[model samples]
Target: MMAGTHGQLWYLGMMEENKLKTSEGTLEKARNSEEWRCQGLSTQRSCHFMAFPSFEHVITMDSLCFDSWFTPSWLDEEPARNGFAQDGNRCNDHALPPDATAFVTILRNCAKNKDLRKGTKVHDDITKMGLLEKCSDALVTMYAKCGALSKAKELLELHISRNLFSWTALISAYAQQGLGKEAVDCFEKMQRAGLSPDAVTFTSILKAYGSIGAADKGERVHDEVVHQGLLENDVMLGTALVDMYAKCGALAKARQVFQNLSSRNVITWSALITGYAQQGEAVQAYACYEQMQSEGLFPDAKTYACILKACGDMGAKDKGECIHNEISRQGLLANDFVLGTALVDMYAKCGVLVKAQQVFENLPHRDVTSWSALIEGYAQHGQGEQALKTFEQMQGGGLAPNEVTFTSILKACGALGAVAKGKQIHDEIARQGLLGSNFLLDTALVDMYAKCGALAQAQKVLDELLLRDISTWSALIMGYAQQGQCEQAVTCLEQMQQEGLFPDAVIFSSLLNACSHSGRVHDGHLYFTLLSKKYGIKPDLEHYACMVDLFGRSGHIDKAVGVIQGMPFSDNLEVWSILLGACRKWGDVNVGRWAFEHAIQFDRENTAAYLLMADLYAAVGMHNDAKSNQALRMDNEGLKMLEVVV
Candidate 1:
C-alpha cells in the first residue's frame, strides 16, 4: 500500500503480495474546521488493510461502455499559463494544480472493483481539493459503479461540462438499480445534450425498458441500433435486445430476433428460457433448454434453475430427476443455495416428497425459501403432520418464517383440521404485521379457517382483511361450500360480482361443487352457463367435470348427457364416469351403455367408469350385460379392473 500527501490531496493505491493493485483510497485529513467536518468520511476515516491478499497479479479494469472518441471541446479549454493582466486576463500565480490524471486513475480503479467504502474517502479528498470541475466524469463513474447513484446523478447535473461517459455511467447504474423510469429520464437528458449514444449506451437503455416492460420504447431503441448497424458486430447488444423483448412479454418478436442473431451464448438462451418459464409456457421453456444444449452450450446455473422451474410447472418428475442428476454431477448445489432451493421446490411440485426432503436435508445451507419449499410440498400433498414438523424445525433453527412459510403452514393446519394451530399461526402473522401487507397471507389465513370447518371465523377474517382479491373471497365461498352452505356460497358469489370481481373458472368450479353437494342443480346449471356466456371464461376440464357431477347427483341423467354433448372438446374419463354414476342412481341403462362406451374409448383403463356401468346394469337386473362388461374389462389387456358381482 502507498499513501502520501501530494499538495493538499492524498494519493493511495492497494498493494498485494508481489504485485501492485490499483484501488481508490485516501488519507483522513484532520477535521479541524466545519468544512472538514462536513466532508469527513467518518470518525474512523483511515484506510483499514492489515495485509492485502495475493491475487494473480492481473488487475483488470472494466471496458468503458461509452464513446471512446471524445469531442475536441476539452482540448480547446486549456487554462491560461501567463501572469494576469489588469483587464481580467487569465493568470498563473499558482505554481500548478495537483495532477488530475492520478486522481482520475484511482477513481476509475475504485469503480472497477466497486470499492465504495474506500471510494468515499477518495470522494472526500476530491471535494476538498476543488477538483470537482476537472474530474467530474471520473467521479460520477466511480460513484455510479460503487452504487452511490444519487451522488453520481447530482455530480453529473452540477457539472455542465460533463462528458458522454458521465451520463452513460449514471444511466447504466439507474437501470441496474431497477429505476427504469429514472434511467429513461437520464437517457433522454443525454439525448438533449446533443450527444449520440454508442452501442453500449443503447444496450443499457434497452435493459431499462425491459425492467419496466416498456416494449414500445424498447422497439424504438431497437430501431436505432439497427439503423446504426451496431447489431451486426455486437453479440452482447443483440442479446440485450432479445432480453428486452422477452421481458416485455413480446415473446414472438423475441424469438424472431433470437433466430436472426448470428451468434448465441448461455446468457441469451437463459433470457429466452426465463421468459418462457415466467409466462407459464413450460413446454416451450423445456424445449429451448434442450435446444441450447444441442447447440453444444452447457447449461449454466441460471439456465438449470429456469429449466427446473419449467419441469415443476409441467409436473415432469422424470425430467426433473434428470436435471437433478446433472446438477449433482456438476457440483453446482454445493455453494449455490438458490439453486438448492430451486431443486427442493422442483421435486416438491412433482409430488416426490421424499426426494424433496432428501435434497433439502443435504443442502449445504438452508434459507426460508428452501424450508418453505419442503413444508409447502407436505401441505399440498396432504401430509399435514410432516408439514407441521418441518415448520417447527425451521423455527427451531432461528429462522423466522416469512410470508411464504406462513402460507404453507396455514395450509397444513387447515388440511389437518387444526383450528387451534391455525389461530396460533394467525396470531403470529398478525404480530409480524403481515396481515394487511400481503394478500397471499390473507388468502391463506381465510382458507385455513375455512378448511377447518370454522365458517364464522373464516368469514370474520375475510371481512376484516384490508385487501381482498378474488382468491380471498373464493376462499370464504369454498369454505361455505365445503360446509354444505350452498345458499351462503351463492350469496357470496353475488357479493363478489357486486364488488366488480367476475368469477374465474376456479371460482365457478367451487360454486358448482357446492351446488352439486347441496343438490342445487339449477343454480349449478346457471353458473355453468354464465361461465362461458357472461364471464367469457372458457370452462376447463375441471369445470366441465364439476357441471357433470352437479347434474348426475340430481337424477338429471339426460341433462348430464346434454352437458357432455355440448362440450367443445373431447370427453374425459371423469365426465363419463360421473354420468355413469348418474345412470346407476336413476336406473338408466341406455345412457349407461353410451357413457361406458365413450369412457372406454377415452381411456380403456377407466376402472371407475367400468365399475359404475357394471353396477348400474346389475341393479337393473341385466345380469348378462354386467357379466359381459366384467369379462371385457378383465380381458382388456393392460386394464386393471375389480371383479363385479351380478
Candidate 2:
C-alpha cells in the first residue's frame, strides 16, 4: 500500500495480483475478476460524495484509484467510462420503494424543496411508473403543499383509498390560504368518505370554522371530536375548542369547556381571557388572568393583549398601567404591537389622553391603529383642532389614514364647525375613494356638511348615497330644520316614514320645529298627536315649547294658554310670556289681562312679560289702566317698564 496526499493509505499491489493473462483482453479479465465485480462510479458520489467508508478494500488498486480519481469537471456531471459513456453506472441504489410511504415521502420532499418544477417532474415520474394508485396520500399532500389544491382534490376523488391524513392535508392547505369555507367543505367530504379524523384534523377544522366566525359549525366539530373519543387526552383539542367558542361570542360555553379542561396551558388561559375581554367583561377577564398567574403560569403576549383590551373597554386606566409595567418588566414592550396598541386605546378610552399620547409616542413601530387611537382621543375630548393637526402629522409621518381616522377627524371638524377644514377633509376623503363607502363613513360626511351649515352639500351627499339608514335620514331632516327650511324638513320626515322607518324623538322634534318655524299649525298638531298615540313617544319640554310657539305665532292665545296648562311640568315663564305676547298682538284685553297676571304670578321679575302686559293694556284703549299696569309692573319687578325692550 502507498500513502495518498492526505496520508491515507492506498493499496498498491492488488491490481497486479487480480489481473489474469486470459484469452480475453486486460479489460475483460479485470471485469471477470471478483475484485471488479459489482463495482462502478456512482452518481451520488459524482454529484456529492456520501460519507460511507471504503467497502471494497479487497478490490485491486486500479478499482480503488478509479473510485478516488474524480475530475472536478465531472464532479456534478454524468458518470462515464474511460472518458466514454457507460451504462448503469449512475443508477440510484435507494430509488423510491413501491409503497404509500415512499411516494408520500417523495411528495413531502418536493414540497420541502419548494421547487415546483422538480415537484412536477417527480409527480410525472410517479405517474409514468404507475405509482399514482398507491400514492394518493403523497400526491394529495404534494399538490396541497405546492398550492395546487384543485389538482389535489381531483386526485383525491380519483382514489377510493382516502384517509384522514389525506383529508387533513387538503384542509390545512385551504386554511393556510385563508379559504376557511373550502377547508370546512373538505372536512365534510372527508366525513362523507367514512374517514375518521384525528386530533390534528379536528384542530384544523375547528380553526377554519373559527376563522370565518361559523360558531354553529365550530360547535358541531367540537361534538364530532367528542363523539370520536378523541378529546380524552388532547390538550390542543381543548384549547382550540375554547378559542373557537370564545371567538364566536359563546363565552359561557367557552368557560364551561375551559373549566372542564383537565390540564391548562398558556394558550388556554389566553383564549378564555381574550374571550372575556372581547365580551367587555373586564372584571372577569382580569380575575382569570390573575388566576392564571397565581397557578404559576406565565402570561404570554396574547395574555397581556387580552387584559390590556379589557382595560380599554372597562376604562381601567390604572390596571392597564399595571399591565404595562409587567410587560415592561418582562421586557416584551418593544415588539408587541397588539399589547402596545391596546395600551394606547386603553389610555384614550379612559380619558387619560396624555398617557395615551405618551404611549403612542413611545411605540417603536406605529400602524394605522396607533394613529387612530390618538385621533379618536383628541376628537373625543373636544379638541378638534388638535385632532386635525395630529391627523396631518400622521400623514406626514407616512402613515396613510384609514376610514376610522377620517371619521374621527370629521367628527372633530363637525364639533368645531370648522367649515373650511371640513371641506378639505371631504375633498381628501373623495380623493382617497372613501367618499363612496357605506353607512358609517357616509353618515360622517353628511354630519360634517350639516354641522358646517352647508345644507346643499349635505343633501348632495344624501342624493349620492345608494342606501340610507335612520342616521342618513336623521342627518338630512336635522340639517333642514337647523337651517329653518320648514317645507324641506317636513318632506324629509314624510319620506323617512315612507321608507318604513318610524320617526324617533329626534325626527319628531325636527318636524315639530319645522311646523313652529313655518307656522304649519295643522301639520304640527298631527305630528304631536301621532307622537303620543301611535309611536308612544311622550312629548318632552322642547316639543311642548315648539307647540306653544306654533299656536302663539298664529294668534291662538287661548289655545296656547291651554297647551301650557296641560303640560306635565308646571309652565315656565317663557310659555306664559308667549301666551301673553299673542294676546297683546290680537288686542284681546280680557285674555291678555288674565295671561299677564298669570305671567306675573309665575315670575315677578319677568321684564319681557311685564312689557307685553303694559302694551296689551294700551292696545285696549285704556290709557290710565295701561299706565297703572306699567307702574305696577315696574314697582313689582324692580325695574321701569319703559326701559324694557319688549
Candidate 3:
C-alpha cells in the first residue's frame, strides 16, 4: 500500500509539470498571434474585424480576464470612415482591456499618419483605461511626430517613467524643426536621465549642431561617438559627422572624419563636395568630384548641382560646359529643375549669356528660380534691355515676381536709365508693400532712382526708409556726386557719419570723384586724409585712381604725378592716362610726352592714350608728331575692327 501511494504521488507531480508546460505554451502561442494580428492591422487599408483565435486569453490572469481580445481592425483607419468616437468607443464599442501592445500600435500609427487628433483621442482612451504611464513613451512619440512638441513635453513630464524613445523623439522633433539649442538642451536632459543616446539620436543631434553652425558642440558629440565606438561601426553616423563639421566651416575636421570612415559612399563624397562648394572652394570641390569619379561612384542630381554651383562661383566656363554636356548625356536635365537652374546660373555667371539663354529655353518647366537666374544673368552682364524683356515675359507666363526678381529687374532699370520703368517698379513695390519692410528692395529702389538721375526721388526714398543702411546713404551720395553737386554730396556724407554710419571704400571713391568734377581740391585733400586717419580705411586701387583724377583735373599736375609715384599698384594705365590728359589740357608738351611714353609702356594697345597724345601734339603745333600718332590711332582702330569681324 505504501509503494502504491509513492507511485500515485510521483504520478501527481508529473501531471502538475505537464499542466504547467501546456499553460506556458498557450501563452507563447497567444503572444505570437498578437504580434501577427498587430502586423496585419498595421497593413490593412480599412477597418474590418477578423477573429484571431491565438490572441484568446492572451493576457495574464492577474489582469481582468477575457475570453478573447478584439484587435482593432486597422490602426491606420481614417476616423471619418469609422464615425469618430471618443474615449474607448472604437469600432464596436467593445471595451477592450488596456493592452500595452494595442496602445503602442495605435499610437505608432497615429504618429506615422501625423494625425494629432487621432493621437489625442487614443491618448484619452489610454488615460480612461488607466494605462497612461504604461503608454507614455508611445504617446510622447506620437505627439512629437505629429509636431505637437509642447504636448509631448507635457506628457513626458507627467509620466515618472520616461524612456529613451520618448526623449529621442522630442529631441528629433526640435532638431528637425531647426530649434538646435532646444534639441541640445533635450540631449543634455536625456544624458542626465541616465539614458545613453543611440546612433539615430546622435544623427539628429549632430544635424542640430550643423543647422546652427555649432562646430564646438559637434566636436563634443564626436568625442561621445568615439567613446561609444560608433564611428567605425556605422557609416551613416560617420557621414553625419563629416556633414556636420563641413557645414560648420570646419573642413579640416570634416576631412579627418571623412578619411577615418572605413567605408565611403556617394553620400559621404557628396557631403564633402557640397561643403567645399558652399565655401567657394571650387578647386577642392572639383578635385573631390574627380576623386569620387575615379572611385567608380557615379554622380547623382545633387552632386551635379553642387559641382555646377562651384563652377559658377569660379566662372569656370569650360568646366561648366563639360559638366553640362555630361548632364545632358545622362538625361538628368529632363526633369531636374534644380540641376537645370544650376546650369543656367553657371553659364550666366561665366559671361556665356547665349548658352545661358539656350539652357533657359530648353528647361522643360521653369519656376521662379529659372526666370530669376536668366534675369539676373542679363542684369549682371549689363544687358538691361534683355533683362527687362525677360521680366515682362515672366509676368506674361502668369508668374508673379518675388523680391529677388524685383531686385534684379530694378538693377536692369538703373543700368538702362529707364526712369519711367523705374517709377512703374516703384509703384509695384508699393503695391506689394515691400518698401516698408524689405531693406534690400528699398535700397535697390534708392539705387535705381539715383542711377536714373532722379536725385530728389532717391533722397525721398532714403528719407522714407525707417532704417537706412550704409548702402542707402551711399547711393544718394553717389547720385549727387555724379551730378557734380559737391555741397549736397558733402552734406549727405556728414549726415551719414552723424547717423553713426562709417564710410567704406566705395563711398570715399564717390566723394573723391565729386571733388574732382567740382574742382574742390582742398576738400578732396581733407577727405583723403580723413579716409586713412579718421576712418582707418586703407585705400585700394580705385581710391588711388580717384585721387589721381582729383589732382590732375584741378591743374595740380605735379601733385597728380606725386600721387602716381606714391601709388602701391603697378602697371596701372588709368593714372598715367589721366596725367597725359591733364598735360594736354595744360599744354605741357614735355610732360605730355613723358606721360604718353609711360602710358603706352604700361598698356601698349591703349588707343585712347594714343589719341590723347596726338591731340596734345596738335595743341602744341607739332604737326609731324601729331600726324604720326593719328596714323597709329587709325591703324589700331583697323586692328580692332578686324578682330571684331573675325
How would the candidate models be sorted by TM-score, starting from the highest?
3, 1, 2
Can you list the residue pairs that collide in candidate 2?
none
Q: Can you write out model 3's per-residue Cα lDDT over 415-502, one digit (the tens) per residue?
A: 9999899999999988988886877788889999999999999999998888888988888889999999999999999888888889
- Candidate 2 lDDT tens digits, 601-622: 8777777776776777667776
Q: Model 3, 263: alpha-carbon shift in Å?
A: 3.5
Ranking by lDDT: 3, 1, 2
- For model 2, the stretches where C-alpha displacement exceeds 4 angstroms are 1-215, 222-231, 291-296, 418-438, 486-490, 493-646
The count of backbone overlaps in candidate 3 is 0
Question: Which ten contiguous residues of candidate 2 have the minimum total lDDT?
Answer: 67-76
List, residue by residue over 565-595, the lDDT tens digit for candidate 1. 9888887888988888888899999998888
Q: What is the C-alpha local distance difference test score of each model?
A: 0.78, 0.74, 0.79
Candidate 1, residue 502: lDDT: 78
Query: Which candidate, 1 or 2, has the higher TM-score?
Result: 1
1 or 2, greater by lDDT: 1
- State in Å the error of residue 413, model 2: 3.2
